[model samples]
Target: MAITNNRMICRTVFAATLLTAPFQIFTSAIGQVYPSLTLLFALMLFLFYDVSKVLKTSLTMKTWAALVLVQIISLLWAVDIREGIREIVYSFSFFLVFGASMQESKRNLRSLTLLIIAYSVLTLSQSTLVIYFRLIPDVKIQYLQGHLAEIFTSPNTLIDLFGSERNNVLDEAKSGGFEVNANTGAAWVGMVGMVTMGLAIGLRRKLLFFVSLFHLVAVFFSGSKAASLLVCCLLALMYLTVYISKKFTPSRFAILISFVVLLTVAGSIVVAAGSATDFGQASSDTLDTRKLIWAHAAVEFLKHPILGQGFGGWSETFQAYAWRQKISDGYPPHDTLIRLWSQSGLIAALVGAAFMIAFSVEVLTLVRSGSRTAAWIGAGIWCGFLFVSIQGLGENWGLLGTLRMSPFIAACFALSRALGYYTSPATRSSVLNTSVRQIKYV
Candidate 1:
């Protein structure tokens, strides 16, 4: 009977849940609405959305059980058991929701946009909450109290995270190593910010502009140089696309051209204004720190090729090099891929990179298709995802690598499916079969 209504209620609820949650991503401590809210929605769907009725076994849809199985196996061997297990729990649910949200075989573009917007709101609001409460409680401040950018270069490096003046940084009490790792904060910002810009430009939606803006703010506050730089790169790419396209009439072209000019002007003004603010100094310092970290990461990667060491092996292995070289760091290898290879071995890196490459191809196709909203969203989503990926090259991110590997990868898969980015021949045949069944009922 529920199937008779095209399961409209189920579909709508699933759509709304994904849309809202995608918009509000943030750090764990932030009072963001995404994780809890979306989990509830997934639970409701799991309870009522009959798989036998709505979903046919098809290659087009994401293989939920397969993902969960892989995650479980990986968790069993992971160096960080609690984190691995927690990620698997979150990712399993995430994949299920992602795979189940779309209709038949088609992608829903607006719903996806809504999901991205929801994350933006939740992240911005939660970030505000953190700022208001001043609840950035990290116990290890002394670890990062001094060495700003002295990792790669001499002890007296030119640029410092606290700026040219280390005393000013000490005065501000922003010395926690993990707190400023950027991967810890910047990762989330880049994840949301880069993607939103691409979405706004591709969709021609006004709301996404503000969505992009808030994400930008989050990136700034994260003090992650990689995040901020990626933002500039992604935004520039989006704008350049618009500027180069000769589709609009002269008036529309002029309007767009003028808007771009004004945007650049406004951005410059913002930059100049920010130069006087604490964020400007902090951001500049963060950028410098990343360079030092990047240099260190490159060296580590060079030392351990092919098999590398085992998982959780980088910290110990890296210290030997660090001590011999005299690089000051609160922890070991800074880059995500490098650390993964060092710890989990080359096999882990290949498995992880394969997913990224597959997802990227899917996203690229969606961008070029031009007819589907799903396609366009894929383009936008990748813009954001890439920023995170680039930043990942510098820091450990998620469940598989940087951020929190499972959720990031699962979200990628889910969104990819939503965009019709991963449709396969078997899946297409299954969808055709589903349509035939629906027609018989009619």
Candidate 2:
């Protein structure tokens, strides 16, 4: 009875974290506490109950360990050793808490999908209250103490919270729900929004599919143009995945994915060529700024080519190089791949690339499998990752220090292990039989 109760409590805590982990508003309300209290407590419970199992069966353990080691070794070249060490500790801790807690199974995947949808609903409701009724907390902005004023007394502060800087559409008082910046909220919503849509279609829940559209409205309210564009692209991809799953063979689906990727790249190049120097409009200005940042980053990478400036070297490197570029120090290279390459150099970039490729291959395998449920979950996770990576080209959401996006990434990868669990002989046979029957009826 005691063991059973403990197991139940463990599962409950894990479920709660899944629902609340992506929203920045929750983290802000809790005073910027990282990894969350629930995560820590659950880590303890996991240690007590399933430590051996977690260590033995975990797919990401070795890769995470290698990544951690790379960061630790890079500290030798890091100008800011203290910050570098802090990053190392953070990655290791996240591995222990989030990376270990994941179990590869269809049950857990479905639960995670539901929790993501719930997170979307909660965020949308919070934003709606702030937008319609001027309801926002009167507490201090814990995350932005120095950059922003300590206390938010008026509705203007609340409006600023939702990233009104780039948000021309929403009213000034639009709150960012749990996140301090509206852009981050938009990015968070965009990722989960894709998941909700994918899950709805995968599970044949028509009402859930329609209801999930509200999340896009929430993203628009966030007022981050980057997020808005990314969500639009992801929504198209989400629908495409559904259509392809129903109509195409596995080999054709793979070809379609490749073709779409090439087409997206070609379109982006054409757009960039058309507006390469237009600094008047927002979209063009953003593109121009990223190009400049990437240029600067490439120059910096040449300075310390092998290991680069090391982990958490962004500010220090920027401080040294900003005078040359005539820009402020806080403006990081604005690209995740460029930032990693410039900071940790070639080795770190390779590690990051390998990690992403492994993750992508795993997700793709699941999509190509005959199981519809597994395919939907895989496509959702894959698309969410692609959105973040695309966003990273214009911003640094996926960087190591950005804890805001970390939990969401962790959730996707953790749930992705469902491929192995759901592809057993019995499950595959059942899925195959169902597919054949449906085709016959058609």
Candidate 3:
């Protein structure tokens, strides 16, 4: 009876986590202290579960652990040790929860599908609400209800009501959703939306198709160029996955060759475009903002090179350089790869890179497996996560900060791994056959 009771409680908590993920907007819409109830519940679950399970299942997670250890060691030399410690704690807590909570089963897959749809809906709704306010200038519920109601208004409205007086909490624009900034909103959409797209294709769930479309609309409304591009890339990748599944036998050589060719073409195009313009040209200056930030970051990385100036030191170092160059401080270089190299040194950066490589390989292995449903889903997540990671080249907040989406990405990968095992060779044929019948019925 006690074991049964425990099982029931675990199921309830997991379900609650999925449900709570969508409602996070309600708190963010208001000026509530606990912003992400989903993350909070996730953290609670992480603490309550067995710690050993994290290492036993996911190979990617073991690499992640090494990355964390590197970061912890860097804290010894960090100028702001307190901030460095906080960063470590935040990372550890997130991975711990994610590792503990995710499972491999049909029931969990269904739950994940629901969670993705809910999250996408919430983001779309938030963006839509903001757009509505923008279109209808006279939607003055706040002014009619007095100063207190100003807090109840959307971030954009609050900015209009209080102007510069708006607190950081109230400082939102339509570019972001429930996240702190427009960029964060767009980043989350890119990562989570990609995961959803993968799961949808893998499960062959018709509902997810529409949900993904809605997610794209939300990403578009968020006004993130990186995110917009990521969504387009995700669609292209999904199409490619389906095409390959139909035409090819999911061979590693074919997939690798195709990926290499695609990347080469894309890289060549970017390089050609950049080389066509002079550095001092108008086109260059518009793009040079990020380049300049990166240039400054590169210099900082060189100065420290090995152990680095330590966590939070890159920004300080960049600020000093920016002041000399008559540019502003407080804004990062908008690149996670370089930021890691600058802040944590080559060791930490190598660890991070290893994690990415390991995770990608694992997903690819799943894709090449006999499990058709698992393969498509794994492909979706791998492609989606790749899009987000590529987009991170220009947008640093996708990882290792308050705006980080890496944990969720990890969780999705873990889910894919779990689902891959659940749908083995013997069972996959049966599952696909049943799915075909069900589709025919519908």
Candidate 4:
């Protein structure tokens, strides 16, 4: 009974962590504190329940630990010690979450799937709400904002707790629901869409298929070029996978090809239409800014190619570099590899590369483990990871050192490891079969 109770507690905390993860973009203090607390609680529960398992050392863990160690050591020369310490703490949290997710995945795959589905549904609902309000006319937006403010607080205190600025609050009223930033929100929704698509195809559930479509459509409202492009790419990839797996009759193949052509044409139309709008111009401006930042980041990386700037030192380094070049102090490094190379140096970048390679290999192993269910789910998780990684190309949040979306990435890594373990030859007996049966029933 004690063991069962512990499992229940662990599962509840795990669910809470994933469900609240979408709200991590909330700029308020509570938005940050609650998710962090849940993560910390989950880690503690795993430690208390199974210390040995939690502490079990694996190659991936070793690489992750070494990477963390490098980040810590880099702090010795970091421009801002406080920022470096904060980043290190976030890195440690990600490590803990990664281990906990692996343990949770092994304990109950069925529960994990249900939790992920629930998370997807929640994110979908949030995205739907945001898109719905965004479609409303600009004239009534003020009225809607005022009404929402009245419902939440006094008229004088109009700003929502989720945002610090009135303009941000108004933006939230217009198009942001639970997530403060459109791009981040779209990325979260895109990740959920990938997982939902996998579950829909794997489980052959019609409702989940519609949910996935909704996710795809809703992401466009966020106006995140990366999310939009990657989700479409993933969709095409999914279609290709289906086409390759089944031997279709001539007519069926023709139908599939026709569908693909239509999708391609429709996407082209959307792109053409969007490019003529102010949103397109804004996206172009953002891309130009990213290019500028990347160029500056390359110069900074070249300056200290060996050790680079210390951890959390990129901002200061960029600021100084910007001053020297007589350019406006722009954003920090927009690319993850660039961030790592410029901040932690070449050695840390090598460690990061090794960790990513190991991580990808584990995920791929699950995808090709000869289990249809595991393969579909693994593929979805991989797509989700890929989406975030692509997002990292134009954003600073990598697979580590931040709370924004790192937990989700860590969860993906953990689930991949767990699924790989379960489908391995040594564990492919009663346990794996039983888990599959449970998933089927679910």
TM values, all candidates: 0.57, 0.74, 0.76, 0.77
Q: Model 1 has how many clashing residue pairs?
A: 26
**lDDT of all the models against the reference?**
0.48, 0.56, 0.58, 0.64
Name the best candidate (by TM-score).
4
Q: Which candidate would rank higher by TM-score, 2 or 4?
A: 4
Candidate 3 C-alpha lDDT tens digits along 179-243: 43455566566666666666666666788766666666677665454455556656676656645
lDDT of 4 by residue, 244-337 (tens): 4334244653564465457645754565568767666655666677777888777776778888887667766667766775655645677777
* lDDT (10s digit) by residue, model 2, range 76-136: 7777676666566556555644543464223244455455556656655544532332233
Candidate 4, residue 127: the lDDT equals 78
Q: Could you tell me the TM-score of candidate 3?
A: 0.76
The TM-score of predicted model 1 comes to 0.57
**Worst 10-residue lDDT window, candidate 1:** 149-158
TM-score of 4: 0.77
Give the candidate order by descending TM-score.
Answer: 4, 3, 2, 1
Better of 1 and 3 by lDDT: 3
Q: Number of clashes in model 3?
A: 3
Q: Which stretches of model 3 miss by more than 4 angstroms?
A: 1-5, 22-36, 104-109, 126-174, 245-286, 398-407, 426-442
lDDT value, residue 308 of candidate 1: 54
Tell me the lDDT of model 1 at 158.
21
